[model samples]
Target: MLRAIIVDDEELSVKRLKRLLSESKDIETCHTFMNPLEAYEYAKSSPVDVAFLDISMPELDGMALSGLLLDLDNAMDIVFVTGHDEYALQAFDASALDYLLKPVTAERLDKTLAKIRKNRGYTAAEPALSVFLFNGLRLCRSRKGQETIRLRSPKTEELFAFLMFRRAISREEIVDTLWSDLETDKALKNLNSTLYYIRKAIGSGQTGDCIEAGRHEIRIAESSLYCDLYEFERLLKQIRSAPEPSADLFKRAEVLYTGEFLKGKSYEWASEQTRRLEQDYIELLEAAARFHIGIHQPQQSLRYFCEILKLDAIREDISHEVIRLYTELGRKHEAFQQYRLLEQSLQQELGTRPDPRVEDFIMKLMR
Candidate 1:
């Protein structure tokens, strides 16, 4: 029983491959991603025995995406599924185990599976513990399914989240940060109560030892946690330090930020971080847009521009860029429509219309 992921930009291709893969008894589960970036993100936290990737994909090609996946788990097999045969040589050079041409036959896929099994002996899937902090804090403890634990109280939940955020903090610091409004004795008492509640909530299991408390300090046992937030931050740092950051890396990080960090909660300490993460997400979108523009892929860049507007709708500058992209892509009507929406947004929200420059830009494009 092996887990596999199918990545292809084409919707029909992805569906077809997924259907075919599902027929195989060797495959326990088959996840499909039309977005290469999403496939890369899924592979990061999940254990995949083999990845069936399309050789040619927008944003990130199959070869480059496969390399990144291999970096995560070098033991995993890479199988390139494409309509082209020219890339077969290059695919092997990248250490791909097999290359299957498009409209893949069942017989061919079976052969690839056999090769993978021969290369890496089949083993039972292992249970994994994962913490997702994008839209909210959710715990998943196994490949079988996700586990969403309910805390005893809001304060207990906050206390657990606080520890996850700080990784490790002195008892004094924890009390000061989370319970500063209370009397010193009361604050310490509250902290103790909350810690007990948190322990009760997570209970004894794979995640039982995730939180460790000492006499003077408490910490998250990172080895016991596979946190999305940690991975997102790590990708951001890696991209910033890299001489030539990969757009796929940016997209992977961008996908992790499904919403504001710890959203729907009012943790005073977390507000600033939420804003910072959103800004980081916007910047990644900007970088991806810029990359598409550099490659003369206005359609791709336009998609990113629209996404930016979704996050920061009031950015007249971004709106202007989007209008320009719409115009360049021969979508004058959409360009006008975009302007009207921005116009309405500004007037209704900020008591103004689109900037005069934006109006002029659209008018020129219309002519």
Candidate 2:
């Protein structure tokens, strides 16, 4: 059992975390402080095993308060509990044991406590770090439910994503890829800061071992990291190569691609790969649509067709198919709406009207 103290400026936050700590068997006594100075004062005389500090506090922030607490007893584990996610680098720099985001869940707190235990040599640390690139860049831990990691800056995210995608990259390549617009000196300095942020974000525990940085080159320890893109593409390959792929296999691969590769981020290097993955997604949707058609489920097939059109509005073939599906499902009005949407999209995007044949086809189907 360990003695723990939580310091947060918000009284509600302190109470909430204290309640969560109450459920933990590893924690013998839990103390709460609404003031950072008071928490520091308490730690001065009474050395606790764990100090839970809120990063954004009044008088003295958690980072500074933690430094003072550690000065008293370096063995004391510091866990940062705060609403802001950007303080990860500072927290790690202060030698914090773990970082927890706001509205802390019981499960996440358990993981933090587990990390403390691992630090105390009570148990071995588990490889819980994972990178999720679909929909956006998400660095998640925990297999049960995601504990997403939010990095401090876009450069930090890009550096981590670049490293994850390449696995290993030269120092020159990193600077060229990420900092080509800046002078060599400034670029190198930025790279150094970004690299430090990456390592700090990963933490100082066993998970830290996943990223191996050297003078000439830096590489990700593939064994320690579980990247969703890797598994997603692997599933796609398996499903594509199979003689007769099952619907279950298609569903598995389809769900893994939550959205286009790194959706919403304007990363030049990722544009090509994003396009490729989108093409793959469109193809998967096409296959699923055809399967639904074969089974006489035009409604289900229509859904897949609409999904494909959402990704590529100028897909005249899919648009025609959607109109036909709507007509066949006894919704001629919707078929006409689909046709008008296609016409507008084609006109606006391609600077050309939809093929006359599409309107003709819709007319015949409606009649």
Candidates' C-alpha lDDT: 0.82, 0.82
Clashing pairs in 1: none
* True-structure lDDT of candidate 1: 0.82
Give the runs in model 1 whose Cα sits over 4 Å from its true position. 1-128, 143-145
lDDT of 2 by residue, 169-243 (tens): 898899999999999889989998998887788784756788888988989876576777876776675556455
For residues 1-367, write the lDDT of model 1, one tens digit per residue: 6899999988888887786676555688899998999998898889999899998998899999999999999988899999989998999999999999877765566678889877887543343566677788776666334666777888887888888888999999998999888988999999988898777767755466888888999988765657778878877765664445656777778778878789887899998888888898888888888888888988888888899999878899888889898878788899899898898889888998878889888778767
Among these predictions, the greatest TM-score belongs to 1
Candidate 1 to truth, TM: 0.63
Clashing pairs in 2: none
